[model samples]
Target: MSAPAKASADPAAPGERQGTRRRRHKGIAGNALWFWIFVGPFVVGLLIFSYLPIIWSLVLSFFEAYNTATPSKFVGLRNYVDMLTDHNFLSSLGTFTIFAVFIVPLTFVLALALALLVNQVKIARAFFRSVFFLPTACSYVVASLIWKLSIFNGVRFGLANTVLGWFGIENIAWLSTVDPPWYWIPLVTVRLWLQLGFYMILFIAGLQRISPTLYEAAYVDGAKPGWQVFRYITLPQLRATSVAVLILNLIAAYQAFDEFYNLVGNVNYARPPLVYLYSISLGSIQDLGHGSAGALILAVIIMIVTLLQNRIFGFGKAGD
Candidate 1:
């Protein structure tokens, strides 16, 4: 009889247990309130600033938004379709593609080499690193202005022309010359000089992460002085960092504007898409719709390139 009564009482015990659970539920709700209070500012800011702006941009891309006195007009995909047929848009893409083809690989290789050399040095390492990175601290406009007026200036007053005179050669027009001679040489030179140090720092950090013991093991296996352990050990270990540096270089090369703007101004010979967009909207004519259309097209291209790179190189993968 006592065992049967105890068994029957067990079913009623849940009611008391339910009261305990209700207390715990109230406590959890209070804790959640406090957590939200602490984090609410950041959440609100992101929603208002970042997300809202993105929504606005997407909306504006569908309509003709002007910076001038004209009223906004709904043009759907007219801007996008016009972009496909625009010769200047095609030229800009072609120009940037060519620039990236040369610049990206060159930047990566040179930066890696610089990092290796700097890492191996025992003395004045800090000084050399600072010297290399100094160019990055300078504004692109300042560097471009100096290069335009002093270094690669086409005038007899320029340092380059002065040097050529020493070899009994006539002072040549450096900037005005069409392609292989004028535009690319100085552009590539300045671009490399400015960007190399930043990428070198990234590579140096990657190199430091590699274990010295691995290098020692390779050396024990009779790895020669000039022959690198990079093929087997260093590269595999630093694959993530290499992919990161490549992606960053790709984005920078595509969005390049300040250097080209200051050096070449409105000159189409070396104009990148961003520069051309600026020329159309802000500089020459107040064609805001065209500029926005160009900008949106560029955004799409960047997105596509990023996706392709991620797929090909597994860029988003961590060390695992």
Candidate 2:
């Protein structure tokens, strides 16, 4: 009977599968269109405003671009060659190094101390955090002016000088004195105050992430208050955060300009590399090529230092 005349096979089955496949393709295409539509503006903005300018600056560094309407002449590395021998460039580099040495360690310690205190406190937490972070909210320029004129001013009207008189320590030249003492004290002090709050916040975030169980474990292990869990448990766990703080502090120290400018006003003694670059770029007649070259060099130095930090600290590694 041939299986009672084989039932007619369903013809719509293959068509239904094909229709479902088309729907999936359409859905994927729609999602892709939406993604590009959303991200396109940001991508274009970065290309036009951020990266394009950097590219042009690098190109300008290669050619002799006049500050005026004068045409850019291709000088083929003359700028780079001259910057290598410039006395001012050398001086600025040395000064920045000295500043970094003092600023980085000091800021880290101050921030750590502030974080520990805030973490240990049980009351008025919001008030303490706000009080500490208030300075960071102010613009660097405003803060620098206050420190320069109001706090570190050498005159009798200055707050510090008034307090010094009460202690019989005499008037201290907070800005003008050369190295060993005057060079760093005021700058470091102000920088420490301004930076400690931000880093304290970072450390607070990191500390809060640590399990209370670890502290309890340390206590059970008889870890002393001063002799502390930091060296053992805390340090190991917070290694990544410590690296971040160090890298940030290092970059801040190197790029230090606002405080130097507001307080020292492009004077040689208090100038960092950035301040020197600004002066040459805007103020000098003969050194525009050299100035551009100096800036590129400074940029290179900063990049190298940042890369070194990443390498040593394993900052960008997956686990880190």
Candidate 3:
């Protein structure tokens, strides 16, 4: 046994394994370096532009930062107290609540109707989709302006008044009269026009995701063509999509500023939370502290509402 020279058991094996490991380590390091190189700037920018501003705003909210962004004259929770107690702000919220109640359902139903109708069309489907979706590309500001100046300018020449004139009705001041709150008509319509198309697209996507086999099975079970199938199958299938649309609609209703601001202008009755906060921040008050406090409060309210909606709808659950 001692005479048998021990064969060097793959003498290069250990060195080759070590070299492979070195190469792997170098490759890993290179990938890591490249990742950081690409991602570092975005991270830095987010901290600087988004997070820092929020932190600064929070800090300013604690102080008397009137007409300025910098924190000055620490007043603790005075800004929050004043904002919460402000009658005008509370009234605006009340009005907004009524508006939300009206708009959310209207938009949901209209969009769903449009989606169902569009989904039924076997020919020129893309053309219809594009036609419906074109409004979503429109600027809210531009839409507001058109609705304000051309459609419902509270003048005899305005489109709405002109339509009424043809109907043997008097040319009514739509925006100018707060007594009837007729401004809501244009506000609601413009928002519907701008939003309905986008939501229709969402519904269309949801509709497409429904398996045709389900419909076939329903038909086999003697389900009717329209109402019965829709009530029993289509609607239930679109539950998640409905929840999402409702949530988005509610939030958008709350954030309605451009239309209110452009159309209603300084009308105490029509100012939503954003418009009210805008006035507080940029108006004669110029109270940055109060504006920041209001914004934070609105954000908290929106978050709570969104959570409640998710809980009620079981948004992310498998069954939902």
Highest lDDT: which candidate?
Answer: 3
Q: Give all TM-scores, in the order shown.
A: 0.82, 0.84, 0.89
Given candidate 1, what's the lDDT at residue 226?
A: 52
Clashing pairs in 3: none
Better candidate number, 2 or 3, judged by TM-score:
3
| lDDT (Cα, tens digit) per residue for candidate 2, span 91-112 | 8889899899889988888888
Q: Name the lDDT value of residue 223 in candidate 1.
A: 85
| TM-score-sorted candidate list, best first | 3, 2, 1
The number of the candidate with the highest TM-score is 3
> Which of 1 and 2 is ahead in TM-score?
2
State the lDDT of candidate 3 residue by residue for 1-320, as single tens digits: 64322333444666666767899999999999999999989999999999998888788789988888876599999989998999988988888998898899999999999999999999999999999999999998999999989988777899988999899998888887777878889889999999999999999999988899999999999999999999999999999899889999999999999888888886788889999998988799898999888888888899999999999987887254
| Weakest lDDT window of 10 consecutive positions for candidate 1 | 62-71
- Model 1, residue 162: C-alpha shift (Å): 1.8
Ranking by lDDT: 3, 1, 2
Question: Could you give candidate 1's per-residue lDDT for residues 1-320 as a string of tens digits?
Answer: 89756755686777656866898998899899988998999999999998875566566666776665343788988877887788887888888998999899999999988998998999999998988888888788888888889998988989889999899888777777884457676677788899899999998899899999988998999886554776788778778888889999999999999877877777766788998888877775866667777787898989999999999989778474
Task: Please give the lDDT score for candidate 3.
Answer: 0.89
For candidate 2, the lDDT comes to 0.80
